[model samples]
Target chain A: AQSVAQPEDQVNVAEGNPLTVKCTYSVSGNPYLFWYVQYPNRGLQFLLKYITGDNLVKGSYGFEAEFNKSQTSFHLKKPSALVSDSALYFCAVLSSSASKIIFGSGTRLSIRP
Target chain B: SQTIHQWPATLVQPVGSPLSLECTVEGTSNPNLYWYRQAAGRGLQLLFYSVGIGQISSEVPQNLSASRPQDRQFILSSKKLLLSDSGFYLCATRGDPGTRGYTFGSGTRLTVV
Candidate 1:
């Protein structure tokens, strides 16, 4: 079964500091990885995805993720974090042949001003 | 240009009461629809998904049920709501084949007392 793991439950960072949220996935075939952000009481918003080609994928709101095939990781990163960037981040993986995507447990990102 | 509309945005229901949540899609046709529940504003738990009208696939067996009567309409219902069902419910649609990401609705905050 395909699964996604987000190791950190919460990450705290100062405003303007770099931030990283770790994610790892396990799948049988080619993996379609995605990152989503959710605010309190709201649904998730798509951030980025890695389907093929580029290992470093850029996404909405100055976010980027690196897909490491050998390590089975797709980590979300931002060069400079902002207070508005604080939210719940989820990493999901979908196999090409699968019908649905598998989501990670989620990581709470807190950016202090 | 795909969009998902889920309502009522917020809901309060007593335990054992019947519940219904509706979701509709626009700017797309025959798209895959999904229903997910987020507990405590954290990880998402996929409840159901459908590829076409009248084709529902359940991921977890619980107090909720989903139906797809129209190509763009999806409904989540429960005969008797439980206290545990109180959470944020999200409706989503799979994006185009090239993107392979999901576009989510604004979400419905359901509080079952």
Candidate 2:
């Protein structure tokens, strides 16, 4: 089965510093990877995705993710963390030949100001 | 531009009550719709997805039932809501299934008392 793994349950980062949340996926064929964020009492918001082309894909809220096919990893990254960046983050992989998006266990990101 | 909307931003219902949650998409057609639930401090669990009207695929078997009466409208219902159903409910859609990413609605917070 296709699945995703988030190595960390929580990540703490100081404001103005770079942040990374690790993710790894397992799939049969090439994978379509994604990252999403959810704030308190809000629905999930799309952050970024990797379909093809460049390994590094940039997304909303100054966020980006690197899709490493060899390592089967797609980790979310940000150049500079902000206090407002604290939220729940999820990594997903579309597994089926049809369309099936499977999400990983979420990671809570806390940006200490 | 495309947007997704979910109704009843917050709902507190007693156990054994009938429940209904709605999701609608605007500015798009033939969308692939999805329903998901999240418990507090956890990741998402996909409940159902639809590729077209009157077609629903369930990811997990539970008390929840879903219906898609129109191309861009999806509804999740339960005859008798369980306390375990208390959580955040989210709806999402994609223009096409395999190639595109999903856009999510604002979400509905259901608190079963």
Candidate 3:
């Protein structure tokens, strides 16, 4: 079974500073990775995905994630985070043979001023 | 332009009550649909998925069930709701083969009273 691990339970960053949320995946063959954000009572919104080429994938709200095959990691990053960027973040992975996307334990991002 | 919608946005039910959460997709055909649940401040747990009409695959064995009666519609139901079933329910759709991440719906927040 394919699975994703978000080692960090929470990440605190200063506003206007760079931020990162770490993610690693375990799977057979190739893996498709994704990042999503969820607010208070809303559902998750898609941020980015890595299916094929370009190890560095860009996503919404000025977020980007790097897919490292050797490390089995797809870390989400942002050059500068806004106060409003603080939310719950999740890392997910999917296999070709799997119909459902497996999600991580989630990382709560807190942007401090 | 594919869009997904889920309702009602928030529901409060008593224990042992029945549930019928509806999800529908527009502007997409034969899309893969998924249902996921997230506890407060936790990651998502895949509940079920569908490849086509009347085709459902359950990821976890629980009190919940899902059905895809229409090509672009999916419903999550349960005969008797439990207190453990209170959470945020999300519906999503993937566009093509080899694609994993998805377009998500607005989610339904269910609180078992």
Q: Compared with the true structure, what per-residue lDDT tens digits does model 2 show for residues B12-92?
A: 999999999999999888888999998985788989999999999998889999999999999999999999999999999
Q: After superposition, how far is residue B57 of candidate 3 from its true place, in Å?
A: 1.5
Compute the lDDT of residue A71 as modeled in candidate 1. 100
The whole-model lDDT of each prediction reads 0.93, 0.91, 0.91
Considering every candidate listed, which one attains the maximal TM-score? 1
Candidate 2 similarity to native, TM-score: 0.94
lDDT string, candidate 3, A22-110, tens digits: 99999887898999898988878889999999999998999999999999999999999899999999998888777667889999999
What DockQ was computed for model 3? 0.64
Q: What DockQ does every candidate get?
A: 0.75, 0.63, 0.64
lDDT of 3 by residue, B1-113 (tens): 67999999999999999999999999889998999998875888889999999999998999999999999899999999999999999999986634436888989999998
Docking class for model 3 is medium
The predictions' CA RMSDs to the true structure, in order, are 1.1, 1.6, 1.6
TM-score of chain A of 1: 0.99
Candidate 1: lDDT over CA atoms?
0.93
Highest DockQ scorer: 1
Candidates arranged by TM-score, highest first:
1, 2, 3
- The runs of at least 3 residues in candidate 1 whose Cα sits more than 4 Å from the true structure, single-residue gaps closed, are none
